[model samples]
Target: MNDKQVMVKMVFDRWYALLKNCDTLLNSLTDEQLLREIAPGKNRGIYLLGHLIAVHDDMLPILGLGDKQHAELFEMFLKSPDSKSTEGIPSVGELRSHWSKQNVMLKEKFDGLTADDWFGKHNSVSAEDFIKEPHRNKLNIILTRTTHLAYHHGQLMLIKQ
Candidate 1:
């Protein structure tokens, strides 16, 4: 395969694997379990899940995929610190549904990109800069988000016990 094709495959594989692992861990939890905090003041499982959903939803714009599908999520999850407030934040079931839909939409958009588009400019990278540093292309976003997922996935594990 060409370099762009290979890069896309690798990035997608790793991203999918990490997402699956996170989903499995998340699905195993009860709604009440998701509300429990990892520590006294730290984020709860539900909060983290909403944060992840909002972050991933934002990725649509950041990756030049499209406008965000859930703009309200940014305020509810990203704009504030972890809250048990539940005033605006979605419930566990709602967040789970949002998470699934956002990911599926992301995957669909990702699949539509041409091989060359993978090496094209992303959110911040200028055309010149992208050519100079191809590693900063769209695929790198997946790598960055993969690490982010792993970080929160570790936190999600703490809610289990």
Candidate 2:
């Protein structure tokens, strides 16, 4: 494989692996377990899952994939941290479905991109700005989001115990 192919593969592999690990841990937990905070005053497992879904959903637009499918989730998950108010949050089942759908959709969109496409600027950057900062490409988004996934995944582990 060429350099671009090799680089994309490496990042993609890490992303998929981290996602799978997160999914396994998430699936193993009950809704009650997820509702508890990873630590007092910190985010809960359910909140983290919803936050991840919203963040990944937003990546669709940022990566030039498509419009977000779960923008409504940003209110409870992204715009705010965990709280006593569980007002309009979706059920754990719904959140799980959303998470699954997001990953499948993302994988399909990501698979469509060629190595050259991976090197192209994501929607977040201007053409001129991208030229000045070539490192901020589609692959970099996956890399950064993967790290984000790993961070939350680690937090989710606290619930598993």
**Which predicted model would earn the best TM-score?**
2
Residue pairs of candidate 1 with colliding backbone atoms: none
lDDT by residue for model 2 (1-161), tens: 99989988998989999989988998899989988889888888889989999999989999888899998998889998687456778988899999998889899999999999999999999999999999989889988998999988888998778
Model 2 vs. true fold: TM: 0.97
- TM-score per model over all chains: 0.92, 0.97
Q: What is the lDDT of residue 70 in candidate 1?
A: 86
- Candidate 2: where is the Cα deviation over 4 Å? none
Q: What do the candidate models score in CA lDDT, each in turn?
A: 0.86, 0.89
Candidate 1 local lDDT, 126-161, one digit each (tens): 888878888897777778889999999999999999
